[model samples]
Target: MAYLFLFGAIVAEVIGAISTRFSEGFTRVLPTVVAVVGVVGAYFLLSRALRAGMGIGVAYAIWAALGVCAVALVGVLFLGESLTGVQAAGVALVIGGVACLELGGQH
Candidate 1:
C-alpha cells in the first residue's frame, strides 16, 4: 500500500541518519556502508510511494517530519545526545504540523 511504502521511506531515512552519526564522518567502514545503503533504499521506497498515488507535498512532508522525529529520538536514546527544551518544542510543533496537514487534506 502507498501508506506502507511511505512508512518504509521514513524508517529508512531515520535509520540512515542515525547510522551516519555512528559512521564517524565516514571513517568507520561498516556504519558508513550501512548509512549509504539505507539512504539509497529510503529514496527508492519514497519514489515508489509517490508512484502509488500519494500527493508529493503530503508524502514529502510526512517523510521529512517523521524522519526528523525518529532521528532525534534515536540520538537522545542511543547516542546519548542532549535535547534541550527548545528542540523538544520544535519537534512537537513539527508533529503538530504533520497532523494538521494530514487532517486538513483528508476528504
Candidate 2:
C-alpha cells in the first residue's frame, strides 16, 4: 500500500500540473481550483506513502519522475506543446536515473 499511495501522489501531481496549464496564470477559475486542490492532495498522499515505509529519496524521485513524464505527455496530447528529440532524450535520462536510484539501493 505504500506503492499505492505513491501512485496516488504521482497521479494527483500529474493532474495538478495539467490543470495548471489550463489555469491561464491563475486567471481562470475551475482549472485553477483543480490545480490547487490536486497539488494539496498530492502532498498529503505522498506523506502517507512515506509514513508507510517508503524511503524519502526513493519516493520523491519516483513521484517527480512519473509526474513529469505524465505531464509532458498530457502537454503533447492535449495542450499542443512541442516534444522535440531533446525532450525525449531528457525524459529517457530521467527514467534511467530513476532506475539507477531504485537499483543502486536495493539490498
Candidate 3:
C-alpha cells in the first residue's frame, strides 16, 4: 500500500535525522554512512509512495511534519539536546497541522 511506503519513508527520514546527530558533521565514518543511507533511502521510498498514488500535498506534509517531531524527540532523549517548552509546543503544532491536513480530506 502507498501508506505503507509512506510509513517506511517516514521511518527512514527519522533514522536519518537522528543519525545526523551521531554523524559529527560527517567526520565520523560509520554514523556518517548510516546517515547518508537513511536519508537517501527515505527519498527513494517517498518517491515510490508518490508514484503509487498518495496525494502529494497530504503525504509530503505528513512525512515532513512527523519527521521533524520524531527527530526532535530523539535529540532530547538520546543526544543530549535541550528541548525548551516552546520547542515542545512547536512540535505539537506541527503534528496538529499534519493531522488537519490528513483529516481535512474527509470533508
Best by TM-score: 2
lDDT of 3 by residue, 37-106 (tens): 9999999999999999989999899989988988888888987899999999999999999999889987
lDDT string for model 1 (7-106, tens) is 9999899878988988999999999988998899999999999999988888999999999999999889988899999999999999999999989898
lDDT (10s digit) by residue, model 2, range 10-81: 999998988898899999999999999999999999999999999999999999998998888888998789
For model 2, the local distance difference test gives 0.94
lDDT for every model?
0.92, 0.94, 0.90
Ranking by lDDT: 2, 1, 3
Q: What lDDT does candidate 2 reach at residue 63? A: 95
Model 2 lowest lDDT segment of ten: 70-79
lDDT of 3 at 21: 80
Clashes of 2: 0
Using lDDT as the measure, the top candidate is 2
